[model samples]
Target: MSQRSFRRSIAIWLAALFAAYLALAYFAAPEFWTFRDRGFRTQHFEMVTHTPQGIPGDPINVGLVGTQKEVVHAFAVAGWDTADAVTLKTAIEIGESVLFDHPYPDAPVSRLLFDGRAQDLAFEKPVGAPAPRRDDGRVWETPCGGGGGRPRWGGSASFDRGVGLSHDTGAVTHHIGPDIDAERDFLMRDLATAGVLISTGDISGVGATSTGRNGGGDPYFTDGEAIVGILKQ
Candidate 1:
C-alpha cells in the first residue's frame, strides 16, 4: 500500500464509480447506457396484460407508462411520495372502504381496502388462496388511449382481489356492497387522515372509480389509487 498509496486507492475507487454512474444516470434505469444518456427510451408493453380491478379486488393491470421523472424522483428521494402528494393535495386517495356485516344497501357485496393496493401486482392467483378468481372470462375493454384502445377510463385494471393485506394495521379488507359510496366514504373517513383517495366522482359500486361526476368533491379527477380502511397501528 505505498505506490503513492496504490494510486490513492485507485483514485478513491474511481471517484465512487463516477458517483454511482451519475446517480443511476439521473435516477435508475435510464435505459442504462451511462455517461449521460444514450438510446434510453423505455416505457413499452403498449398493450400490456393482467386484468380485473373492481368486483373481486386484488388489483394489477397498470401499464400506461410515461410518468417517469425518475419515477417521481425515486419517491422524492425515498420519503414515500404520494405521487408527490398528488402534486400537493389536490387529491389522491388509494385503498380502504368497508361496510362489513352486510345486510343490503345496494348489495353486490363489499368490504374493500387492500392496502398498498397490491404493490408490483401481477397475481392471477398467488396472493394466497385456493385460487378460482377469473374475470378472464371477458370485458377486455379498449380504445381512446389516443394510441389505440382503453384509457378513457379503460383497459387492464386490478392489483388486489380476495383481498387480505395487513401490515399489522396497514389494513386491507374487501367484500363490497351498498353501492360502494366513494369507496364507502373511504372506509368511513378521508382514509383515516388522507394517506391517499383523489378520484373526483363515479365510485360506481361506491369504491374503485366511476368519474361520471357528482359528490366526488370536484377537483378534477384523474386516473386512480385506493386502500387504507384503517389500521396504521
Candidate 2:
C-alpha cells in the first residue's frame, strides 16, 4: 500500500479504538459513579429470571427494605388487595371475568420469580377494569435475609396494557406499559400517602438505559434506580 494510505488506515484504527473505549467507559460501572454518593444500596439490580418458557422476565423496579410483615402491612395500608394464588378456582374466576364482563378484585397473576423463586407476595389495586384490559398490580418476593432481622423484598409493579402472546417466547403474557418508572412512582406515592414509608432511598437494580423485554417480550424502561422503601413498624 502507499504511504499515505497506510497512515490514513492507522489513523482510522486509532479513532475506532478510542470511540470503543469511550463507549465502554460510559456504560461500564455506570451505577458506580452515578450512585456512589447517593444514600442507597446499589446491589441486586440485575435481570434474574426468564419467562415460563425460559425467556427474560420483567425488570425489578421497586424494593421493600423491611420484613415480610412490614411489607404486607404497607400494601394493606395502601388499600391494595392480595392477589389470589394461581389455581384452578382462580383461573375459572378469571375466565368468568372475561366472559361475563365482571371485575375480579383478587384475580390471579402470571408467575414471576425473584432470585429463582416465585414471588412471596402479590397485590393489586382494583381499578374496575375489565379482564384482559389495562390491569395494574405489583409482585414481591423475599429472596433472602430473616435471621432475626428485616428481610429485603424485591418486586416489580407495572401497568398491564393488554394480554397477548409473548413477542419472544410466544407464551401468554400481559403487555406492560413502556413507562415503568411511572408505576414505580405510583407505588412510592401510595405508600407515602398511607404513611407506611418511614424512609426511602435508591438502589441499582438494573443499569441505566436498559429497555428490558419480559418473557413475553413486553418492553419496559426505567431510570435504573430501584426505589427502596422502609416501612413503618
Candidate 3:
C-alpha cells in the first residue's frame, strides 16, 4: 500500500476506538464497568484490615499470606452500610465462621455489605452463650426506659419490628400514628422477621427482640425501618 493510504488507515482506526470508548462511558454503569471488569483481587489475600475512622466508600487494601505473598489485594467497600462493612472486614481478619443457615465466606461480595449495614454482630458467638464479660452498665437492649437511663417506650408483645418490651414503661411508643396503610407493611415486615430476616426496623427494636421479646404482639410502626437503622448508630 502507498504510505499516504497506510497513514489514513491508522487515523481511521484511532477515531473508531475513541468513539467506542466515549460510547461506553455514556451508556454503561461506571461501577459495573470499573469494578466488575477489573475483577476481585482480594480473593488472593492472606489478611485484610479495615479501619473504623474510614467510611464505607473508602478503599481498603488487603495482603496475601500464601505463596504469592508478593501481591497485594485491592478491595473496594462492598458494604451496604458502614456496620455491615465493618462486620465483613472483621470476619476476614478473624478468618471464617458459620451462623444461621448460610456459610459466610471471604469473597468480595460475601464479606461486603451492599446496604452498607450487616447483621449486627451483637455476640461474637452465635449459636451459644454470649462472651463471658461482666455487664459493663451498657444496656443490651434499647428504647427500654427506667431500667437505667433509657426512656420506657412501653411493653410490646408482638410488634411488627418484633420487639416485645416486657418492661412496663409506657403504653407503647409506636405512636407513629395509626395509619390504615401501615397494616400490610407491618404484616410483611413481621413475616420477614418470623423467617429470620430482620429488616432495618427489626434492628432498631433490637432491645425488645433479643432475650426479652417474642412472647406477644406490639402493633405499631415504632420507627421506620430505614430510620431505626440510622438511629442505632
Candidate 4:
C-alpha cells in the first residue's frame, strides 16, 4: 500500500475508537455521567456513605420503603441480627472475635455516614461462627425524613470476605467482595422467604460498568438498579 493510504487508514481506525469511547461515556452509567444533578428523593440512587473527612464512600445498592418498625421486623424474620451500637463493650467483642477466633454475630460496624450521621440500622448474618472472615451484612439509613406519611430508607449491603488495612489511610478496614450485587439479591431473597416483603422494585442511576473503590479503597460493583422493597407490618 502507498504511505499516504496507510496513514489515512490508521487515522480512520483511531477516529472510530474515539467515537466508541465517547458513546460509552455518554450512555453508560447514569450515576457517573449525571452525578451533579443527583438528589436522594428525585434520583434513583445516591452515594453509599461518606468518610469521616467527608470523602465519598460506597455506592448504595439496596433500598427499603417502609417504616422503621417494619424494617426491624423484616430483618428479624430474615434471620439477621441487629448490629450492636458502637460502644466499648461491642468494640472489645469484635476485637476478640478477630484475635481469639470467636464469633460475634452482632459485632458493631465501623461508622459510615449518611446525611452527616451514622447508619440508623445495621444487620448481619454470621458465617461459620468464629471464622476470621467471610460474613454477610448491611448498613441501612433513612436519608430523607418521613414527610406526608412517606417513610423510606436505603443503604448498601456487602459481604466482608476478609479484613485488612486501608490502602489510603492505613487503618484497619473490612475487605468487601467485588460481587456486591449478589449480596443485595441475597437480602431480598431472605426477606421474601420470610414473607415480609410487600413489593419489590428497581430504580436507575446506581449501576456502573466498572467496579469502584470506596473511601477505604475497598473494591465494589453493582447492577446500578437499586433494589427497593416495601415490608409488611
As for TM-score, the candidate ahead, 2 or 4, is 4
Q: Candidate 1, 116: how far from true, in Å? A: 25
Best by lDDT: 4
Angstrom error of the Cα, residue 11, model 1: value is 8.6
lDDT of 3 by residue, 139-226 (tens): 0122223323423111111112211221222111111122212432442333234432222232222221112211111222223221
* Model 4, span 20-87: residue lDDT tens: 75555334432342354244333233455665544456667777877778888888889998888878
Predicted structure 3, TM vs. truth: 0.16
Model 3 worst lDDT window (10 residues): 67-76
The residue pairs found clashing in candidate 2 are 45-205, 50-55, 51-55
Which rank order by TM-score, best down to worst?
A: 4, 2, 1, 3
Off by over 4 Å in 3: 31-56, 59-233
**C-alpha RMSD between model 3 and the true structure:** 21.2
By summed lDDT, the worst window of 10 consecutive residues in model 2 runs over: 36-45
lDDT (C-alpha) at residue 217 in model 2: 69
Put down candidate 1 lDDT per residue, 151-226, tens digits, no spaces. Answer: 2221222212333422111123221122222332322242224432222222222234444221111211223442
TM-score of each: 0.19, 0.73, 0.16, 0.73
Tens digit of lDDT per residue, candidate 2, span 115-216? Answer: 546677888875665656543555555655633467777788777776675564344556778887888889888999999987888878666655677656
